[model samples]
Target: MLPSKTSVTDRSWRAGTAPGALPLLGHVPALWRRPLEFLASLPAHGDLVEVRLGPARAYLAAHPELVRHVLLNPRLFDKGGVFDKARQLLGNSLSVSRGEEHRFQRRLIQPAFHPTRIAAYTTAVAADTRTVTDAWRAGETRDIGDAMHSLLMRVAARTLFSTGLDEATVEEARQCLRTVSHGIYKRTVAPLGIMEKLPTPANRAYDHANARLRQIVADMIAVRRRSDEDHGDLLSTLLRAEHPETGQKLDDGQLLDQVVTFLVAGSETTASTLAFVFHLMGRLPEVEKRVHAEVDAALGGRTPVHEDLPALPYIRNVITETLRLYPPSWMAMRVAAEDVELGGRKVPAGTMILYSPYALHHNPDLFPDPEIFDADRWAGERAAQVPRGALLPFGAGSHKCIGDVLALTETALIVATVAARWRLRPEPGSALRPEPKATLEPGPLPMVLERR
Candidate 1:
């Protein structure tokens, strides 16, 4: 029976009593099958629902208020547990650390992604986009996912590592990234500490990919150290950076970790976003017309400049709306550090908490006709009705994406530049579907780019 408010004890309140799990594998099958559907179904049962893993219970909170509390109160919670496993691939970079250590690392790494600095990289982004698009013959078939990936790969190569590793090396890193991303989810769901011991096919790929990633990042770091000349890439910045208070630079290991963090975090998310943008434009004609009009008016037959970014509201909305529907980091997880009370319920320590941005964005109460692609929602009085944290595609509070501005600027410029020059339509009979991994992307989005 469901207990009344005062009758429930703290432990029961926190636990919230969940449905029984399937035998040994527990909810792993459901989680693997359709994670977003699994998350969306939780709210119908209760505000908080627990699902048993092999042994431990993973708690999910559905309400926005609870999400705000968890995000804002970093003291009460931290990005450890789940992130620790990720740091195996990312190192001790900003994505995993906490408190003063996290603060210092973010400080040293922040300058490279700053607005002025990101603007400085626009020329490279434009050049890369032009280079890739120029080869397209009129009415030729293309896989947009592959195209976007190539463009993002070039951007990361130019803007991320200071050593400027050649294209072949960066391609190797991209391969490793795909393997590691798949590995992280598989390893995390496997029984703790058993991932490395297992001889499964997935585990074998994980091991090989992780080694390749580490070796490439390590080689780039060594080259950076030996160089006397300065290049303004993120790797160079980290190599030369000194902690403001301690006046100490990162050692070789730490530097490699940071590089790994940048590659894994920066590359896929940007590529996924551009793929979504193209998919949306294909479906929404009015949005495409307005966006193209805005770009034409702003550029006036000239190439996009960094200064024009602020004046492009419709472009910003298109990017924001894409993120809302298809957030890069779809699910965020945290383990309870201590017995705590949330939303008038007492949750015990060691419970894994899950937040689903995909579910929240689709909440009909917050966003009417939530599934529709509408950019005007953000333009005028319509945006005011939405709650503060409700529109988070880059997330909210302290753990929000550090590279959001860079992502948006790259999206606007790349999309506008390409859209102005070509008309993209889905290949006949191809249905755009969401292939959810670390981010939402249209799998092998085959489209024809016709010369405008």
Candidate 2:
């Protein structure tokens, strides 16, 4: 028998259960079939709906206000669930750290992403973007997804560490990162303890990739230590950072975690977002024209600089609209630290809570004609009217993405630099679909590079 829907005033703290749950698997089959659609439909069931993934029961927050409440009260709902799975690969990095440790790590890493510091990186961002786009011929066919991933990886290595990796190493790192990301996703959803320990092909591959990632980080750390010189980059900042109160520095293991966190976190999301933006442009020619015009007018054929960012409002809007439609970090999970009342319902301690930017961005009530791509919605007063917590592509509160400034800067600069010179034309019959891995990525965006 399926669980019944409960009323808000029941006061029993019993959440309305989703329909079509099987005997033991619960809603796992439905979620596995269409994860995004299944999550989006939960609000119709109740404000706070019960979801059973295997034997574990979790609450899905469907209302924007409830999501806001949960995000704001991080102490009551600390990072857990999927993040705990993420820690197996990420170690105790900022993304997985809790309480005082997370705060201290944030402080140590905060200076690297400051506006002034991010501004200094803009020159390198533009130069790196140009190097890739300049190589594209007028009639060349390319996989834009691969191009964006490669471009962002190079930019990250250069801007974050002031190091240039050979093409082979970059390719190897990309593959290894993808493996680790896929492994984390698999473990989060399936969570078979015994399966992870067995020498299955997937398990063996994950272990190998993880070891390679660690070795790469160790090598980078060694080189930084040997140089012992400040390159005025993020690596230099992290190496020199000290806690204000304790005056203690991060040990090698902690430093490795932070470095790997920045590289993996920064590269994947930015690349996925850029790839989506290019795909959207290919589908919507009118939007592409506006973006190209804005870039041309603002930049005048020169590479983008810090000053050009503000002048290119249309380009920024295109990026914003793209994020609204396809947020890279689509969903986040937190565990209740204590039994807490939410939406007039008591959620017991040890319960997991999930909030999806993907669902929130697609809510028809919050955004009119939610499925359409409209950059105009973000222009002028329309942008301000978007409710708080309604548009969280970068997330909210203390755990919000630390790389927002850098990510936005890189996107705008890349868009302007490329749009000024070439138009990406999606090849006919190209199968573009959202493959939800660690990030919401568009798979293999094949397109022709048409010179403007």
Candidate 3:
């Protein structure tokens, strides 16, 4: 029987197991088979369920309220696990930093994402979107996933660093990022130090990619410093920014770290989201029709501009519903800094805490007909009814994505621009599957582009 709310609140700390736990392996096998499905099933076991990752005991917060409490109190639950592994590529940037360092970095980085700053990026976003879509040939089968990644990488390169990168450098950086991203999930879950050090093919590729990425960032920084000119981009902002309290600026190494973090964090999430949005549009004819109509009325066959966003409410809803269904940052890990009570249970210091936005967004109680793709749910009063911490595509609390405004603007403009031109239809025998990586990506999405 399920534990009653009052009963759960009154009880002391206890561990609950999922259905298919085995000796030593525990629930890892089940997790590997179908991560999203397995995580969604966990709430039935308990709000604070014990998840064993190959003898490492971790607690999964299966309830939204519990997840919120953990996120809001960063002092108690700090970034660790995968985030530590991320530092191998990202260094001590805002995404992985904690406490005072995190606060300082956030203050330095906040201005780049300010409303006025993000609005200025829309012209570049629109131009990049056109560059990709204009090249699409009608009736050709395209890998939507690859297309989105390529397009977003260019958009990120131009918007983040201005015109610092050439086409060859952008392509090289994209390849390097993908190579390093492939092994991040395995490194995070297993984290076997000796195994990672072994001369495996994957390890070799990771090493090569890491070196290339660092070199790319270093080159960009060097060229910018030599020019000594402000181009009014994110890199320029970072170069000029000073810590509010210390008046200290980021050194060259710290600048490289922030650049790497921005590229990895910003590019993949937005690309994955746009890919999923296109995939969904191909499947749901009704949604696609509405999107087309909205875009046509809003853009009038002209290119999308920053001012056009407010007129395309339906396009925004489509992005919101897609995020609810396929959140790019699917799972997060944190370590407890001190003993604390969570869901009325005592959690010891040094415990690993796991939370999945995939699980929380699919809760039937929070979202009725959760599996249905209904963009209208976000329209009018319905969106206001969504519970706090239930729809965290960019996460929540202090660590919430600083580039959220920029990402949303990019997404809205891209969706409007594409839907205004082409209708994407799934190719025959194509199956859409979720590949749970560091980011949750739509695997092997092939579609035929029909010009509107």
Q: RMSD in angstroms, all models?
A: 4.6, 4.6, 3.4
Model 2 scores a TM of 0.93
* Candidate with maximal lDDT: 3
* lDDT of each residue in 300-341, candidate 2, tens digit only: 888888778999999889999999988888777888999987
Per-residue lDDT value at 163 in model 2:
63
Higher-TM-score candidate of 1 and 2:
2
lDDT of 3 by residue, 63-156 (tens): 7767777787799899965677766646889998888889989998788788888776657888888887898999999999999999999998
- List candidate 3 stretches off by more than 4 Å: 1-17
C-alpha TM-scores of all predictions: 0.89, 0.93, 0.94
Clashes per candidate (backbone, < 3 Å) = 1, 0, 0
Query: What's the residue-level lDDT of 34 in candidate 3?
Result: 89
lDDT for model 1: 0.75
Off by over 4 Å in 2: 1-17
**If ranked by TM-score, best first, what sequence of candidates would result?**
3, 2, 1
Measured by TM-score, the strongest candidate is: 3
> Candidate 3 has what TM-score?
0.94
